[model samples]
Target chain A: MPDLGLEVLIKGNNLGRLLGGLWIAIEISLLSIAISIPLGILLGILMTRKNRLIRFLTKFYLEFIRIMPQMVLLFLVFFGTTRSMGWNLPGETAAVIVFVMWGTAEMGDLVRSALLSIPRHQYESSESLGLSRKQTYFYIILPQTLRRLIPVSINLITRMIKTTSLILMIGVVEVLKVGQQIIEANRMSSPNAAFGVFLVIFILYFVICWSVSMTARYLERKWS
Target chain B: MDFAYIERVLPLYERAAALTVQLGMEGILLSIVIGLVCALILYEKIPVLRRIVMIYIEVSRNTPLLVQLFFIYYGLPKIGIVLTPEVCGVAGLAFLGGSYMAEAFRSGLDSVEDIQRESAYSLGMNRMQTIHYVVLPQAVSTSIPALLANIIFLLKETSVFSAISLMDLMFTAKDLIGLYYKTTESLALLVIFYLMILLPVSIVGAVVERRVRYAGFGT
Candidate 1:
């Protein structure tokens, strides 16, 4: 067994780089969630519309997003679009765009499901009180939907953070990529450095996700 | 639709699709086995093993499969633990899928009533015998829908293997697009290929879910 030196991991500014990469992951996730939530709610509402054409369009979009892999979506936005359309998007910008697109579809499905799960009596009660359709949704439905949405959206945030690792393939300097770089740089000094670096990456990811899950649970209990 | 171009690329994509299906099958099998074993250990309440399994699930579920794949592929080589791209891909999928499957199975186990175990014990069955004959059989039946959905999710995620140079369907589509610069055609073909595989799995999942619910499993 190769001895993995902890001293090497802590010294030489490696800690700072790792934290920087983690912050980038967090930033991308936040931006994607910010854009996805409202867009997803709107699309989800449209999906439930009585109109055939609008419902079909929304369903098609949802299915298309669900069927495609995130990696493919990333490739389409980062590589195919720029090459085909002469649009020079930065790697981070491309990552966020793809993430939001993916997140919106996922969140839309969640929102639609949550909305459907609400007891129809709530809508009926609002209607009997002379509430308009829009007011019924806002005053009666949306708050309950928001409660259910919180946990699932937090799960999605965790997913987005994890998925951000894929951006490293397109040359973004995220945590995993930084770990790879550090391992590559120190390959000669310690051949087993890669395993050590990855252990750190795994621990970092575990902390972030476990905390989010705890927060989701807390919110669920509090809201319920 | 350009039949000529599609016809030329059809064989390549078909071969790649076969590989994707193979990977999905092998990965799902391995994950389910590992996941079931982990769930069993947890259910049995093995001392240190339970904590270790929990940590494994937590870590694997939290991280992205792509990073895990890269770590297994590129990172492992630096430590003289080299795995071929295909092995790395399957291992990554199994590790990630196993975590989700473990959770599903655990939930399934929880859903099994405590009285059933007591009844089994009253019938003079040993612990292992009771679990294998009574608890696990019912758990497996109830968890079928969750397992199927998890497997399909694994199948979709297998597309990420294209990045590590696996000759999966997505890789074939990427190569074709790179060569022909026909973005729409390549993506269209790839989308159809995925639907052909995923739609059946999804239908099966829905059917199983409905069956479980009808059986009073409340799924």
Candidate 2:
């Protein structure tokens, strides 16, 4: 086995760089979530509209988002926009845009499913109880949908974090990108840099996602 | 959209799209085999083997697939085991998909009632026969929708192979974008190609999903 550089990353500028990259990943994910949640809720509601034209358009958008890979979406926004409209987006901004698009679409789907899963009788009960339309949604429907949304949304967040690793391909200096730079930097002195650095990164990601999943389960229990 | 450029590159896009489908199908088969093997071993409760399979499933599930691909493709070379990008891509997707499939199978198999196994054994079925005659069929049926969903997911995931420099559809788009320097046409062609392949399957998936889903709600 080759020598390990586990020590090299534990202190100094290397650690800082890795943490900064982690921050970028977190920033992009959180920002995208903030944007997507409301938009996704709106999209989900619009998708359920009785208007045929509006429903058809929303379904087409949802299907289009569903079928394409997130990476392709990133490429579309990053290169396609730059070439076509000259947006000249930075890598981080491009990552955000693509992730927001994906997150919104995914969250919209989840909301639609959650809303669908609510038994029609629950809506009828609220109506029979003389609840207003807005009151019915706020009191009975949205809460149930939000409960189902919690675990799935958290799952999506983990996915968003994992997918953010691909942003390095487009030149965003996220955690995976930092690992690459570190591995490339000490390639001579530390032949096992790839193994060690990536192992740490992998463990970091695993712990976060595992905890998120666990919390999802916990919330499921608590809410139920 | 640049209509003329897109039309000119239609053949190139077609070839690339074919490759993407090939990889996706290969990934599906590979994942199913791994999933079945792992699920069976875990189901049978092999001593140390079960733990090893569990570790493989968890690690693959928890970590990002991009990192896994990088570790295998780039990291392994340092230890003198170099692999082609295509090999790395398929292997990575297989491992990732298998981990997911194993979870699906595990749950599906677990949900199957124990009485069926008892009846199978009582009917003079041996251990293997019991699995073959009774448990396996139920597990497979329960898991079919999840498996099909995985196949579709794996198909979309083939795009990630582009990160490893695999010449799947996404890389073809990336290369074309670099070559033509006209993003809208090349990128749009990529989307249309994927849509052509995935749309039909997704529609079918939605119908099956609704049937399976509502079947659960039968009161």
Candidate 3:
């Protein structure tokens, strides 16, 4: 507060607005992740399928998502879709759509790599034990995949949270947008409002991600 | 299916594509330098400085690149430091790339065993010689895939430049859209332009990763 002198957050309704913005960011990220993980995992597993067509389609989607920026994706879903398809989606809905799409691709890639990291001998041993493909995947491969996947997938969660900030560009009134509004409102009295607001936003982000990473470390050890 | 508008905008797209490449490459190179320096500092492990470096890495990594860009571009002026959009965009990207690159570099350096250093000393190599002749090549080779991937990620991220009017591919696409209002077709073209760059880099990334793996620790 001394360095930033942002106590004006207490003087007006700006505090509530900032908190509400944080809440919306959290809400969107949480909902999107909830929706994405299961579907992404399925896509990841299906990516490893022996069917050439399945791999081809999954690869196409992954490559598309991988190369494109999330900002562009946001524009595509928010502005492009409405312009083209006449769906007239809300900004928040468009934000969720973009996050879910991006998250699923990221998580799918994580799952694929975790699956790839399984030592070949493990699969061989399972095959030698007369396990069917489904049994091998279910009883053998999946548990290890999940264990490896959990630690790495924590990365995607934190990443989604951070990327949610970009929703502001698409006119979603998220935390950064809230900070902007706060600063704009008080710029006459406080020229340094943005400095304080961004510093706080940075701290909030650090805390959220730091805790997530700590839990990831704990899970890695626990699973190990 | 419709080429008239795309044809009209082709020159603008080409100019923006060139600028994107320049920005991305410059950002990538600077970040590699920053990452190497920061990683070395972290490796040497000064107490207070190490703590500061860790905080920088964590804050940069945890916060969104957009916010970082905004802070650098918009918030800095409040403190009487003004930067052009191009400068801010590139620096912001460098910071982002540098943080991740530092992580990769540290792990790469750490993977070089102390025993290797000991062996180098036994072979009459000095510290610098050992690091140069033994450690760095091994470390760089092992981490090449990660380093390349981060560069690609950074390149993709430069699309955020569109927001700040940095005149990159996304910016050009936005201009095209502003003119023609063909959001669907033009945005797809934007993605295509990115794909043209990224897909080959990724293919090379995969090839290098496999060769590095097959070549083993001698690499």
Candidate 4:
């Protein structure tokens, strides 16, 4: 048998450091998710409006965000704006900003589709019952929309959490970054540290994302 | 923002863009093959292979490509398996995209009515002929939107190829930005190049989706 270099993780403070890094990634995504939900609801409502310009703008923003990869957006926010605007933005701040922009667009789209999916007859039936506009929305439309949105938004949460891993590339010192640092420190002592460290990071990500997606699936099954 | 700077970096971006497209196309093709194989295995309900494919789909779908890239590029060498960065990039994309493509194909396959397969069998067609002549055409037609979306997705994911030191578009933009501090110029060019590569594909995908709907293939 050979040295697997798994010991590097047990070596003092290494695993702790990785966990701390994971916390940062989690913090960024959670912050964006918190901010995104309300703003996304607003954007979603705006997207469904009959106005032409608002529709065009919302459509354009969605398409533009969809077309641009999040990595490029990260680079643009982290590196591009700092120099161009002379603003000193931290890596974590830039990560959150970009993630918010992305999450809002995605969440907004999800909301729009969910709202559209409500049949026209539902609204007609509500009006026939002599419910006020606000009452109809509060009573009928919102609840169904919430049901459709919950599972999908849970999926977006997982996507955001997984994508936060890319923030390491911008020097955010996230889990992957911390893992790389440990691997570098132990390179002479542990030739297999890369394998060990990356495998651990991969498992860490898998566990978090897997649980989130599992929740989404459970809700989808229960609801449908 | 800077016209002259953009002009100077245009050649670098062009070369990198070519590599990105090449890598993405190769990865998409490979992923389709891998995905189709897995989907078929699941569709046939192969006992042991079904379990393995299910596990593969879950693991790959849950993990990020960045970590997967790190594993293959850095970790595999530890156990005496070495792959060039280009190879690793393609492998990573295929690994990530394969699960998605498999899900898409599996859904399409599931949507095909069982009555059609039985009809083909009653007409004296063998299993292979039934699958090839009756099932696949309808399955693939229904899967067109998902497959096209996956293709665009795989292409966008190529941005992370820079992590493995592939000289792809993202790498070129970062290199130029670092050297000149011309962030706007570099990033703008990066976005333009990506759009050039992706926008047409999406437009074509939309057109194809519309055509398929009109042609009543999936229905």
| lDDT (Cα) of model 2 | 0.83
TM-score of each: 0.91, 0.91, 0.91, 0.97
Model 1, C-alpha of A135: deviation from truth (Å): 1.7
Q: How accurate is candidate 1 locally (lDDT)?
A: 0.85
lDDT of 4 by residue, B1-219 (tens): 779888888999999999999999999999999999999999989999999999999999898899999999999898888999999999999999999999999988998998899999999999889989999988888888889999998999999999889999989988888899888888889999999999999999999988867543436
What TM-score does prediction 2 earn?
Answer: 0.91
Residue B197 lDDT in candidate 4: 100
Tens digits of per-residue lDDT for model 3 on B22-77?
88998899899989888877977868888888888887888878878877877677
Stretches off by above 4 angstroms in model 1 are: A1-11, A83-86, A186-192, B1-3, B217-219
Docking level for model 2: medium
Off by over 4 Å in 3: A1-5, A116-141
- Per-prediction fnat values? 0.54, 0.71, 0.65, 0.77
What tens-digit string does per-residue lDDT give for candidate 1 at A139-224?
Answer: 88999899889988998999888888788866688998788788778777877777778767877887898899878879878887
lDDT of 2 by residue, A51-143 (tens): 999889888888788788888888888888887786689999999988988899899888988888999999999999999988988899998
lDDT of 3 by residue, A89-117 (tens): 99999999988988888888888888888
Sort candidate 3 into its docking category: medium
Which 10 consecutive positions of candidate 3 chain B have the poorest summed lDDT? B210-219
Per-residue CA lDDT of model 2 for B1-219, tens digit only, reads: 778887888888888888888877887789999999899888889999999999898788777788888888877776677998878888888989998888778877786787888888889999898887788877876776787788788888888888888777888888887887877778778888988888777878767877655432112
lDDT of each: 0.85, 0.83, 0.83, 0.91
In model 4, state the lDDT of residue B124: 100
Q: What is the C-alpha local distance difference test score of candidate 4?
A: 0.91
